[model samples]
Each structure stands twice: as structure tokens, then as C-alpha cells.
Target: MAEEGVMAHIPINHPARPVYRVLAGLIGLYIVVFGVFGLVETAGDDFFSRGSHWVLGLRTNMAFALVSVIFGLVVLFGAVHRGNLGHLMNLTAGVVFLVVGLAMLTVLQTEANILNFSVSTVIVSMLFGLVLLATGLYDKVGPPEHAETEREMRSSSSARPGR
Candidate 1:
């Protein structure tokens, strides 16, 4: 089935899973630091002001900085937690970053751009989203038996013609 192929493509018990997890955690740490700097730079500013304040080479305001701090903390927690929690968090964060980037791009020159996003910020967000997505896709965990089955399925599928 198409769903089976989709689900089966995700590697289970990957050897590099820990590396990806650490990368995700590092991204979370970077976000937290950026947010902290943003908050400091935007102190006393209006929450949603479209001012030219910048942090870590990205435009930010009080509201965006606050949200970033919270989001980064949650991501950090997910990265530290064992099991599927990190997978889910990475997937969710990837989607959120992409959506926010697109949304901000659409309103870059409009008055509705509450996040104070710039082109560089959008690019960074999209890059982060893609990295997180890749990490999530390759970070699945499973028992030994499940991993063996997955390997077998992949081998069989690859051996088939026109598959």
C-alpha cells in the first residue's frame, strides 16, 4: 500500500539517530540563545512593533522573542526526552517553522507582519525547518526485531523491478 511504503521508508534504529538528535538539540539551543539576545535588544519595545531591532542577524520584536524562547525551550525538552517525543516535536517544529516562514514572507511589506521577519529570517527559518524534518525522518526508534523486519522489507522492495 502507499501508506505502507510511506511509513516503511522511515529508517528504524538508525545508527546515526543519536547524531541527528544532537543536531536538533543544538538547533534548539541556538534558538534559545537567539531569543534571549532578541529579548535583551528589544527591551521596552512594543510587543508587536515592526521596529528594526535585530538579533543574531534576524529581525525580532518583543512578541517574537518571547514566543521564540518558549518554543526553543519546548524543543530542547523534546530533544532531551527519550522515545517518540523528540520525533513528534521535531516534525511539529519543522512544520511550524515552514508555515511561519511562508506566512511572514507573504506579509513582508504589509502592516500585518507582526513577527518583524525579514528575508534573511525567512531563509533561516526554512533551513531550520528542513534540517529538523530530515532529523525527524531518520530518528525513528524500534526494537531489534522491528528493525530487522524493516531492513528485510527495504531489501525486498529494492530488489523488485520497477518498484
Candidate 2:
């Protein structure tokens, strides 16, 4: 049998507002990075210097990046207003971005023989996803002072009861 690993808390209840604010800012930065990268890719064929176009083309990547930026904006708003649902929406977007990032990596791996992604690019994407996941998990817990936020989220949920 394998040993179990302890689950880590997201520190949502650290009694400090700065952490959340910092997280929002960081997420926003990540969103901008993606958006900029996508736009650049679209604007030029050799954006990555890999000499090969992304599977969906630079335009498609730009769209995905732009969506990610929008999601980040929502997250920032949530952090500022302390809205639980807004944070959840951000988490959802982050999750989507993570999945897409993974898919992008897999695609790159398949096309490695033709073109390769830089080590930094892979590391950055993976790290970004991990960050988003950690933050989302923390938001889900809503520990300590965030109980109200959590409750508001439950009450406002669109899901039917007893599903």
C-alpha cells in the first residue's frame, strides 16, 4: 500500500487581506502574460522561435488567452469585493485554462519531432495551473472569516436541491 499524503489548506483564513489581494494580482499578471503571448503568436508566424505554428493557430491561441484574461479580471473583482461566486468563477476559468494548458503540452509532445517548446514555457504553464488549483481549493474551503462568503455562494448556486 502507498502512504497517503496530507492535504494542504489554502490559507483563506489567514487573518490578512493582503494575501488574497496579492493572489488576485498574480492571477491578473498570468492572464496578461497569456493574452500577450497569444496576440504575439498571432501577429507573427515565428512568435515562439520554434518555427512551427501552434496547432490551433496563433489566432485561436489569442482567443483562449483573451478568455483567460477575462477570467482573471473576474477574479480580481472577487478579491476586491470579496464575492464568493466571483472567486468560484475565477477558479472555474483557471481550471479550464489548466486543462487547456495540459492539452497544449500534450500536443507539443506529439509534435516534438517537428517543433519543441522551450523548457521555460512548459515550466511556466505547469506552475500557473498549480497556482490556480491551490487558490481555488482554498476558496472552496472558505475557512474562518470566510464562512459568510461560502454560505452566500451556496444560496446563490443555480444547482437544484437534491440532485
Candidate 3:
């Protein structure tokens, strides 16, 4: 008997697998880079009050940087591991980002924004969220025709009688 290959078991029926991987990787990388830049720029200031860091042309603080880095890492992890779990992660992350961005838009310059919120940040976050959300829902768009063909092939082969 032939040894089953890894690809043989991994289901790739989803049309959005490639999209998810790319989105995750890009989003994760951008966040991580933003976090690193933020930390470096404010190295000498008080962690809580240091708001001189610039992320994507918008001002941000150390705390926000930390959150961005952590979130980015999670996204990167999901991107590297594609499957049902990864899709779920992407969906969850997208929702969270969208909510956070929308919430922040209401308190752009208020004291509530201890981490330096801005319109740019909100827009970028929402865009990323949309991308993630779309990619996550790719598999749900429709049933894959290939899966049906595969099933028919299996059933036909199993029904053949030859000793």
C-alpha cells in the first residue's frame, strides 16, 4: 500500500485559504513592526506617559504598542497554521479590531485615549478588520464542487469488484 501523504489528509476545499494566509501575515507583520518602533522611540520616557511614537503616520504610546505587538503575533500564528482553527482566529481578531477602532473613534482626543488615538488609526484598524473578516468567511460563501467530485470518485472506486 502507498503511504498517505500529508497533503492527502489536509482539506483544502476552502477558496479563501490563500487569502487568509496573506492577510494574516501582512497584518501581523505590520503590527509587530509598529510595536517595535513605538518601544524604541519611547525608550527613555515613562512607559505610561510616553506618547511620542508614530505608528503608520499616527501617534501612539507604549501600552498601545504592546497590545499591537501581542495581537500581531497572534495573527501571525494563525496565518502560519491554516485550517478551521485559523479561520476562527481570523474572524475573532477581525471583529475585535473593528469594535476597538469604532470605539476609539468616539474619543479621539479625550483623556480616555491614554494611548494616543487618531482617525488614521481607526481607519487602518477597520480596514484590516474588514480584510480579515472577508477572508475568514470565504469558505462559507458556497459549497466546493471539488469535494463532491472527490466523494463520487471514492464511492465509485469502492464499489468496483476485483480480487
State which candidate has the highest TM-score.
Answer: 1
Tens digit per residue, CA lDDT, model 3, 1-163 = 3227743433335555686678778988998998888777766666566365675676778777777789989988866665667767777888988999988898887878877778889998899898877665652222467556655766798899971
Q: How does candidate 3 fare on TM-score?
A: 0.74
What RMSD does model 3 have? Answer: 9.3
Using TM-score, rank the candidates from best to worst.
1, 3, 2
State TM-scores per candidate: 0.92, 0.50, 0.74
Off by over 4 Å in 3: 1-12, 139-163
Look at candidate 1 and tell me the lDDT of residue 30.
86
- Candidate 1: tens digits of C-alpha lDDT, residues 1-163: 2346676678888988888889889989989998999999999999998999988889999998988899999878877766887887887888888898898799999989888889998998998888888878878877888888878889998999999
Query: What are the clash counts of all predictions, listed in order?
Result: 0, 0, 0
Q: Cα miss at 111, model 2 (Å)?
A: 5.8
lDDT string, candidate 2, 60-92, tens digits: 344455565676576566545554564565566
Which 10-residue window of candidate 2 scores lowest in summed lDDT?
1-10
Best by lDDT: 1
RMSD of each: 2.0, 11.2, 9.3
